[model samples]
Target: MLIPTRVRPSELDRLIAAVDPDLRAPLRGRVDLGGTPLSRATLAAARNSIITPRPLPAPPIAARRIAGVPGAPPVSLYVINQGEPGTRRPAILHIHGGGYVLMRADDTFPQLQTIARAHDCVIVTVDYRLAPETRFPGARDDNEAALRWLHREADSLGVDRSRIAVMGESAGGGHAAMLALAARDRGEVSLVAQILVYPMLDDRTGSRRMPRTGIGEIGWTSAQNRFGWGALLGVAAGSSVVPSGAVPARVPDLAGLPPTFIAVGSIDLFVDEDIDYAHRLIDAGVSTDLMVLDGAYHGFDGAVPDAPVTRRFVASRDAALRRAFTPGGWRRG
Candidate 1:
């Protein structure tokens, strides 16, 4: 694991001080959890303690670049040049994970910066508009435009358009998948690959009940998933009918998409959908890699970086990205 060890005793002291004494037991007991999705209110209640988010250490290099200045709406840009430079490097446009509601390019700065530098690629983190405020297509449009912008200005940015990949986590992952589909359909932009981490693929809920013993411990719950999807769709989540662009699962066709790396924690709310989506991609003749992390949940990589499970998660992710971005990409096993 590249992550430095965070002393549990010291970290727990900070967590205990931040949280209510009464809830400490349950939070500490969460070292083991089954697949059952925890309640949103419960998770929210423990946010201050159990789910403490520490910004990743700063990257060695960093910069920002204007991605797009569409005459309509706001001027959107890409945060670029934050990694070590490599000759004939591949470029990746990253979409930050937030269930499509919160978080932004800047919020995930540490992780993105690390990725940019580690991969030695021109990593561009796009600032997509959030849902409810911007609605469905708005976010997708920004993503597509960013890819188009990447292609159009590839020369200026010293990136190879042919080596472009789309990467994101959670809802951002879903958007990255959708962007590949959209780009394929419109013939607007070409993508070399996509990396989706614990992606929330379906707007609709799944019938399979969560299991009780693995990554389910500290991951997002069914309730949280509902809230996120509802907020993004502007309607109750798990609706029998979802409009296009609202959910990747609802998209009619899955053909002609780019190669994809789909990752999910066994206990994640989107686990089922992520699995099914990967299968669908294979069915459509699109190359796909599916990585199922055991004893891990949504945001596990960021949540408990010190855990052995999460250490393997990050290592796997890095290796996957390296393979995906390698001069000649490899196929899934």
Candidate 2:
């Protein structure tokens, strides 16, 4: 049996009023996927429409490609530098969210430029391979490779090696978490912090076994969750054999990972998992900060940037990043 989740009355009304009439209907219904060619085309179109570019003016943005591991395709990186030339600055490896199957690094240039300017850091957004084609480990490999490339070229890029951090939203957040874990285990680049925004961290979240109420309605739905996770894992969600590195929530130990910040909406599909992950990170002796905004839905901050709630959310995240990158600012618990 499916339990209906209702959005907070005020939020539902606000969202409905803010969205265009053509999109309002789809927002009310589940994002259906059949894994068929036509359905894939429809999904691509919907994803493109939602992320229609609203370019923001900022410092120069450059596009560059880095060589991947032997036999792998080259990875693209969008470089945004806000600091002066020849001055070393903290760097952020930003991953854009698209439910693991849509969007690109280019789609996030406006937001990335804002973060880079605010923090005065170098921002590199990775254009990783998408799924249902590139599947598990493909995107992960690209993210990890980008991190390695950053470290390898830190001096030339004017990046402060010790102050590097990884940041992402939705599926990208999941990738950031996995990258942090891989970095710890591999004893490679040391990350100062990780910022996850309403991350899609658990495959079991959308399954019937872990149902919740008043979530997954306005932005990303449970059906979309299943599709995204399935595409990445190349298997049905809630499977028994999900690889540890593929799913951050599946990792048994969160010890030795960097200090983390997570923000989510009270009524977002990822609220519970985000909260639980923060709890577990705390339990594992990692410093963690979590922000939950009542009555807000997933992607609310980006969708309704002018709203007070969205402003607060962005402010809190910016403050956290500032603290984390400051010398001796973030301390491990």
Candidate 3:
């Protein structure tokens, strides 16, 4: 399922040399596991093949269901590290990454539980319906429903609604962006921040416009990206007429969104799109922080958590969330 590299040997040599020393072993010799792309025929198998979450002593996690947008089924939520009844804590509505087709709400507890404990905040991860099965607006509706539930039931959940933020890595990150946009437009909930890690943003990145030399050669191939977006979009990924609000990058205006933190590996397929989106957000007067990690590829942090760069990326994300949660640290724009 690996997409054969079209990169020239010299170009590849340069890319290999540029890889962080600790993250280079896979690309240097062994085949990269993340290199596989999914087709309609392989979707089920791809969904079954999952990276076993790195186990940690998880804090208590409660299973809850939130009422969905009218007519849709109830949205499932995993509430992690909920605070005491008399107390209130900042909250994050986390979205799990699976290219918008794979993964579930519970899949992220192993890592998110640690963040919840360390930051002393609650995290509500949503189990949004997958695409090609659910298609445009179905997943969006589920996410919106969960965010609304998180806000409307903040008191019961021991959450400080004003301190709420949305976060995700990869496809989840893209959904977080869309959720933030929806929040701004609907005026029902206010978000303090968005933390996106190497998010899958633009539909045009791998299709329509290919990445510049040596980029996107490591993990999360362009072909897989097309499948992911196409499944969620219900049309050719780069098609001109996507349903409005389906793709965050396709949104015309970025104004009035909350403070944003985006981190992407320089060599990731989403690097160009992520950086471009950050710039567009900034241009729209949104507060933004962007970091491009040199020589890293998509999912680098998850792939090599102990690597110095991965640790640093995780620290940066934690710091951003910490500041966003702090009173007087982030102002609604």
Candidate 4:
């Protein structure tokens, strides 16, 4: 975390004014999430209070402990199936966000229930280990194990293995991206699509490259971003020799990845990095859809679920998942 816990006065001079009308109330006069650098000192409180999101009612959620990666502990999973039993359908391996340092999987069951019912699809939300205590490959391995378990049990779970997708928000988005990449490089599991909502992609974002003005002044800030990255990697953020297959943004080749749908707020710190990642995906001949909401900030969809921009983001995500799960497969741009 940087000195001067709150955002600099210069950054806030225009950042607050640029936020969406509906999204301004939460940011108005607020010190951008307590104005504290996320450290072990503040991590506990942030985990308990920072993830206050409004989600829908959930169906009966079945808890299961599945086998983990070799030599690792078992992974926890929440399997939700809204479709008829024995009816094969599309599935989404949903990963929850907490900047790779906070939050849990089951805390988001309410929202997962909505998606499962709406799509009549099987959903498997993973409980990947968080950072600081568990770093880098720990969470990634948990997700990979869950993905493998899903693919392995597709028949018994009434899921169509060919139509599975990976999705997450914020840090969860980073995990989803990493899972997609590992799935590709390992050739063990094939993903139909990747839906990343305002994902934290690059460590260099707030470290090497200064955050753009008007963004990161609210919600998740550069200071938090730096801490989050360092916690995950167990090293300085934007360090040169990170472990292989850790950071999605640092992966050299983007070709052969599944179709990707990315959504980011206009004033979210990740807007530029997400857009650039989308561009690179397109350049790699992959089908990529990017939705940038105007006057929105990080996590605005959850903050103001009923806002117009939020609705648009939700619609785009659903539509992208639908297309990817189609029988014929996703259509290229």
Question: All candidates: CA RMSD in angstroms?
Answer: 7.4, 5.1, 2.5, 2.8
Local distance difference test, candidate 2: 0.80
In the range 128-230, model 4's lDDT, one tens digit per residue, is 8988999889999999999999998888888888889999999899999999999998999889999999998999888898876666766688888899999
Q: Cα lDDT of all candidates, in order?
A: 0.66, 0.80, 0.85, 0.84
Ranked candidates, highest lDDT first: 3, 4, 2, 1
Can you write out model 2's per-residue Cα lDDT over 188-258, one digit (the tens) per residue? 89999999999989998877445465566657778778888988998888899886689898899999999
Q: Which model, 1 or 2, shows the larger TM-score? A: 2
Q: After superposition, how far is residue 318 of candidate 2 from its true place, in Å?
A: 0.9
Q: Could you give candidate 3's per-residue lDDT for residues 1-333 as a string of tens digits?
A: 112244545565676776788887656654333434578888888777675565366678999977899999999988998887757899999998888888887667788999999899999999999988999799989999999999988998899988999999899999999899999999999899999988888887778988787788776778878989999998988998988998899999999999999999888889999999999999999889899999888878766779999888988888889889998775555
How many steric clashes does model 1 contain?
6
Q: What TM-score, over all chains together, does every model reach? A: 0.77, 0.87, 0.93, 0.93
Pairs clashing within candidate 3: none
**Stretches > 4 Å off in candidate 2:** 1-41, 48-51, 82-86, 208-210
Considering every candidate listed, which one attains the maximal TM-score?
3
lDDT of 1: 0.66
Clash count of each predicted structure = 6, 0, 0, 0
Error of 1 at 135 (Å): 0.9
Best by lDDT: 3
